[model samples]
Target: MYYTIGEVANATGIAISTLRYYDREGMFPDMERSSGGIRVFSDKELGTLKVVECLKHAGMSIKDIKEFLGWCQEGDATLPQRRRMFHDRLAEVERQMDELRNTMNLLRYKCWYYDTAVAAGTEDAVRDLPDEDVPEDLRDYRI
Candidate 1:
């Protein structure tokens, strides 16, 4: 079934103007228009919107996504380029995950340090802890 622009915007959590912008950018190359030239989104358009959003969230630029879409239209001949692009995205995501993990580790260590200092009634107890005195898991995780 076809849905109006409002329904598509609501379902996709995208602003109507952004949808129009995506259309202007040729993001939805095959999306339909009604007799009145109103946008009418079908499941295909919805699925494509979801994909565009995912790629955007994953650090792919609109230009790269447009290129990716063009690659799709080129059929199996472009498969290697698409695969390489995704592999690059995966590496970047992995780097981001590692940075987050390090941040969490620092936060965890801070929590432990504060808890120890609070119990001792002063920061003195934890401020200059020796390497051997710190918890093994937190020893290397200080700020």
Candidate 2:
């Protein structure tokens, strides 16, 4: 079904301006215009938007996304390129997952340490960690 920008935003949980920007950026499927120049989106456009959102969430940059869209415009000739893109994205995602898991583990250990310290009546246990003992970038992550 076709939907107005507002309806599409509600359905996709993306901002109306984001949808408009995606259209303007050519990351969206071909869009049709109303008699008065308003944009109308079809089911295909909505599906494409969903895929775009997923790609963005997976850490694909807008520049690469536009390049991917350009490859898409090339039709069957671009399948190999698309496959390579997905392969690269998969590796990147795996690396991010590992980093996230490590961060979560660090946070969990810190929480456990604080909990134990609070129960033991030694708040300083949590507070006395030396800066050198903690990671440089991670110092900002602590509460």
- Candidate with top lDDT is 1
Using all chains and alpha carbons, the TM-scores for the candidates as numbered come to 0.90, 0.82
lDDT of 1 by residue, 79-104 (tens): 99999998999899899899999999
As a whole number from 0 to 100, the lDDT of residue 114 in candidate 1 is 95
Q: How far is 135's C-alpha from truth in model 2 (Å)?
A: 22
- lDDT, model 2, position 7: 94
RMSD of candidate 2 to true structure, Å: 5.7
Q: In model 1, which runs have C-alpha deviations exceeding 4 angstroms? A: none
Candidate that scores best on TM-score: 1
Q: Write the per-residue lDDT of candidate 2 for residues 26-130, one digit (tens) a residue.
A: 876578989998999998887777778878999998888889888988999999999999999999999999999878877876776678588878977667777
